[model samples]
Target: MTVREIATEAYRESVPVLVLSAVGGLFAGVVLGGWTPETEQVAGLLVLVPALLATRGNVYGSLGGRLGSALHQGLVDPTLSLADERVNAAVAASLANGVLVSMLSAVLAVGLLTALGRPSAPLATLVAIALLAGVVSGLILTVVVVSVVFVGYRRGLNPDTLAGPVVTTTGDVVGVATLLVATRIVLALGGG
Candidate 1:
């Protein structure tokens, strides 16, 4: 293919997804901005927000990239199934990393706040919230990233172009929603 053809193909495939991602990001921002009460109630929660969302995007985005590469290489089929050991393994690893990094972020946030003489929620409370949010969002992201990458590949679209934006936007939206839910749960349980 000529350079112009390649450029046109890439632009055609990616532009729509990029536009959708921008809209999704705005939605996520709205949801987050509307959660002022929760943010105020939970000290240092804002600190955890970016870290949590970034971790989801990083972990799941990598998972999506790996799956895309696998699809291209024919190492895995473009189908979600338990029989696909490579897919299963990749997902499991991503989940593990997501959860672990989430917990670490909570601890680090608390530590940083305390070191700076800033008020922070109890360590246990932050950890619980992080853990809950991580598990929920990780599961959701795994399914989403896998499905989008696989389906886009099947449709003859470049999964490489699709995975990053899709995962990042979805991760932001889901991460914020799940974090809010987790915070609410912790507060309702008198933990926060």
Candidate 2:
């Protein structure tokens, strides 16, 4: 084959790694943040980072994997260059999945926190707070992932390489920040 063709094939092969790296970075951040030592007063919130990160990764990673399939099947066309109804459907499906996963994560996080003897708030209240934070962060993450993938695709970039890394890293930053902000809000409101 010609050099041009070889270059094209090489670029195509690199897409998947790009996508996975993005998501992996986000997960790594969560794990790192969770494992960080807290001050004596904040020890109870130790699980906040990992739990939130795990949930974010679960929700976003699943969606990313699905999108990867859609891309593989010629179903992803954000620029209207590839007329495929499946792309739109995939976006909708992924959004829904992200929201649902966020809620579930919130519930589990609250339960785990309570079990660990952190009763700053009641279980119900904690769940509500966690769910709200999770959902918000998930929503943001979904939008970011979708937008990044679309832009990358339109620019003739491979989703495999760009999507995963961008989505995962962005999600990690957003997830940690969101958790901290939400926790602070809950504490302030509850006068804890």
Candidate 3:
């Protein structure tokens, strides 16, 4: 293929995905905007938002990339199955990392806020919210990343080109929405 052909192919494959990502981002923003009451009730929750979302994107995005590479190399099949040890391990590792990072982010947020002498919710409350959000979002993102990468690959599209933006956009939307739900659950349980 010539340079023009390569460019055209990349554009053709990536533009629609990018457009979808933009729409997903706008939807995530709408969800966040509607969660003002939760944020207000849980001090320092806003601080956790970026970190949480970024962690999801980074962790799950890497998982997507790895799966893409594996599929390309024929190291794993392009199907979601626990019977495939490689695919199972990749997903397990991503989920563990997601949960650990989520908890760490909450702890760091609380410590930072306390050091700065700013108001923050209790450490336990933040940890609980983080834990809940992390598990739920991690599960959801795992399935999503796997599905998108596999589907794109099967469709003759490059998963490498699809993984990053899709993961980031889905991560943001799912992370924020999960955080809101977790916060509500924790608060109702007499946390924070």
Per-prediction count of colliding residue pairs? 0, 13, 0
TM-score of 3: 0.97
Model 2 regions more than 4 Å off: 1-43, 80-89, 113-120
Better of 2 and 3 by lDDT: 3
- Model 2 score (lDDT): 0.63
The lDDT values for all models are 0.95, 0.63, 0.95
Error of 2 at 155 (Å): 1.7
Q: Which parts of model 1 are misplaced by more than 4 Å?
A: none
Residue 72, candidate 2: C-alpha displacement in angstroms: 3.2
Q: Listing every candidate in turn, what is its Cα RMSD in Å to the true structure after a full C-alpha superposition?
A: 0.8, 5.3, 1.0
Displacement of residue 86 (Cα, Å) in model 3 is: 0.7
- The runs of at least 3 residues in candidate 3 whose Cα sits more than 4 Å from the true structure, single-residue gaps closed, are none
Tell me the tens digit of each residue's lDDT in model 1 across 93-179. 999999999999999999999999999999999999999999999999998998899889989999999999999999999999999
lDDT of 3 by residue, 109-131 (tens): 99999999999999999999999
Is 2 or 3 the stronger prediction by TM-score?
3
On the 0 to 100 scale, the lDDT of residue 141 in model 3 is 98
